[model samples]
Target: MTPPEAALDTRGTKPPAVLSCPQITTLRHRADFLRAARALRQGTQGMLVQARCRRDNDPTIRVGYTCSKKIGNAVTRNRAKRRLRSVAAEVLTEKARPGWDYVLVGRPGVTVNRDYTDLLGDLNYALRKLHAGQDQ
Candidate 1:
């Protein structure tokens, strides 16, 4: 008979020891968001993306999400932010450059209601535009 620990089927059950890509960080400071505000911006049907390259050599990407009160009451604003966060995580984790900060601003009518695929496309498109503008 096999030992208890050896009896378990662990073929595809083991978790990865390490992630392929570096993990992303969240921007929580007011100064960081303010600084990104002065950087390149691209607006899509769903949301606005603001990106700023940092001087440091950190390999982690930082992101922030915000929605104005004009979007609606507290519930509405939170929903918009939640959608933005999901889209950012999906799109920015692979595509966004390191040593940069990005902020996703929620639009009143478009953010919470837009299709998920369209939101992802918008974020990808916005990032491309922001980077292309930087190279010029």
Candidate 2:
């Protein structure tokens, strides 16, 4: 028996494959995340953070995503990660400072249900709040 071919060829898509932005990764290095948690400025809403900071040699801002087991099952966690990644792309591309890194930690409710535009707005608002906090 022959193997089935994919329904849609990969080439037809636009420049960015869903995962290529590279901003959304787990916060692997303990020190980096610690620095982000400590020295880095932060902002929050009903969700979690939309944070930013400058790092030497890191020319572009990167993002890390998280959702604890309490959030849901595997399918729900994956969906939340995807939504956060998409939002992080919009935040990094548009509002985020160039030399910063972001880490978006998901809250318990509505993370998957929130409107995309509103998610973007929350990210923007959070970044602005973080910056404002920096000034004072």
Candidate 3:
């Protein structure tokens, strides 16, 4: 087998192909999060998920994560947000639809302690529920 560096012919020649997942951007503005809040929502044991489909034809998935003060002090809230971010990175990269915005609200006591697999399932279930509601 060739060495790792040999795999990349980076001498002004064509670069080796890099395999990567599609890019997913974050929702930074308050207005974007508010817009999702006005759309469909589903709550689970660990989180509340809100999703909104945008009218524009952008083909990128946007996500936001929030943990209220009710969750705890700054440190605890930060920890919850971190966990929410990880879950989003794992679940949304594959499951989320493009041209949509999603907001994941962290639960006070459960978000930081819930099992990772359960959290993933909760997000999947919530998204399905939200979409199903829109069909009605």
Candidate 4:
């Protein structure tokens, strides 16, 4: 029965990680997603990866994640996307090429059920094939 402002002390609680990884720029525009879709794409057992060079001289790596309704209802789709984001953070931060945009498309059943390590392997392999000859 205390005042509303005085009753709250949840500052240290673990909230959902919204800006957990700051090094990787997140892609939010539909145009960017479409541009990446028109570019190179590689698929693995866990997910589908689409990548494109922006050619705009920006050293930032931008990425987007998507989950279709085919994955399931809202909860399932979100679960798949969350997994995709987690895997992306682990792999893209090190392996993704700068000045590029990437879109990670979640699979219907594979994304949420696949083992985390295997998901990492899938992303690494897809990236290797996507950026095969461009590396220096």
Candidate 5:
């Protein structure tokens, strides 16, 4: 047999992301939580969303994304969360306010062939809905 060849292993298993959308709670609220509650939330989306009223001193919000094993195997779940994280960084970087913690949970249909713009739009819409509830 010849020496092993080196190439981009597209077939290689994808790795889980280092960033995760951690569950937000009142006790966990620190000085640096970024306030995306008003923006990253949308009740109409029919997704589970919980928020804390406390504020933090950090200038940027900490965000995490989760995909349960039900979504698929380790690879599928990791891919979904990674996509969410990339979109979060691209669109929510400057958009999300400081002092709040945000997390996004993937729905069954969330992993479809959707574009980043569509994801961002959904996020924006949800955020508006969340803020509307705050007004009432």
Candidate 6:
């Protein structure tokens, strides 16, 4: 059977896919996450965002997404992460600042069920607060 993407109609009804997630570097090491955790935190209804300005001048934006077991079982966690990835692809590409590392943590109940537009708004608000030159 043909894949869903390949089975698209000639009428062009299908919307575009998510951004492939390569525009920004990914934060892999535990240290990178720990450091961002120490930097700045902004919480929204859907997710918690941690942002940190990197010391180096690389000008590469880095991002990480995580859903703890508290969020749910493996499948649930994976779903939450997928949604987070999709939202990040939309918001981070433009709103996220260069030379920064950000971690998006999924909340237990809300992350999985929250409306997608609200989720996007949550990330945008968190980013704005972090960059508003607050106490930091």
TM per candidate: 0.83, 0.68, 0.81, 0.82, 0.57, 0.81
User: What does candidate 4's lDDT look like per residue over 1-136, in tens digits?
Assistant: 8977556557766544465332579999999999999999999999999999989877888999999999999999999999999998889988888788999999998899999999999999999999998753
- Write model 1 residue lDDT over 74-121, tens digit each, in one string: 999999999999998899878898888999999998898999999999
Residues 6-102, candidate 2: write the lDDT tens digits.
3555678644345433343445675666566665444444357745465475546667777888778988888888998888776767666656766
As for candidate 6, its clashing pairs are none
Clashes of 3: 0
- Candidate 6: worst-modelled 10 consecutive residues by lDDT: 14-23
The lDDT, on a scale of 0 to 1, for candidate 2 is 0.68
lDDT against the true structure, per candidate, is 0.89, 0.68, 0.88, 0.90, 0.54, 0.90
Question: Which residue runs of candidate 6 sit more than 4 Å off their true CA positions?
Answer: 1-22, 134-136
Tell how far residue 126 is off in model 2, in angstroms.
0.4
Model 4 poorest ten-residue lDDT run: 14-23
Off by over 4 Å in 3: 1-21, 133-136
Where does model 1 exceed 4 Å of error? Answer: 1-18, 133-136
Q: How large an RMSD does model 6 have? A: 9.2
By TM-score, the candidates rank as 1, 4, 3, 6, 2, 5
Q: Which should have the higher lDDT, number 2 or number 3?
A: 3
Model 6 lDDT per residue over 88-119, tens place = 88999888887789999999999999999999
Tens-digit per-residue lDDT, 7-76, candidate 5? 3447786644465433322223433233434434444232333333334454445565666777788877
Candidate 2, superposed: residue stretches over 4 Å from native: 1-28, 40-46, 50-52, 55-57, 133-136
Q: Give the TM-score of candidate 4.
A: 0.82
TM-score of 6: 0.81
The backbone clash count of each candidate, in order, is 0, 1, 0, 0, 17, 0
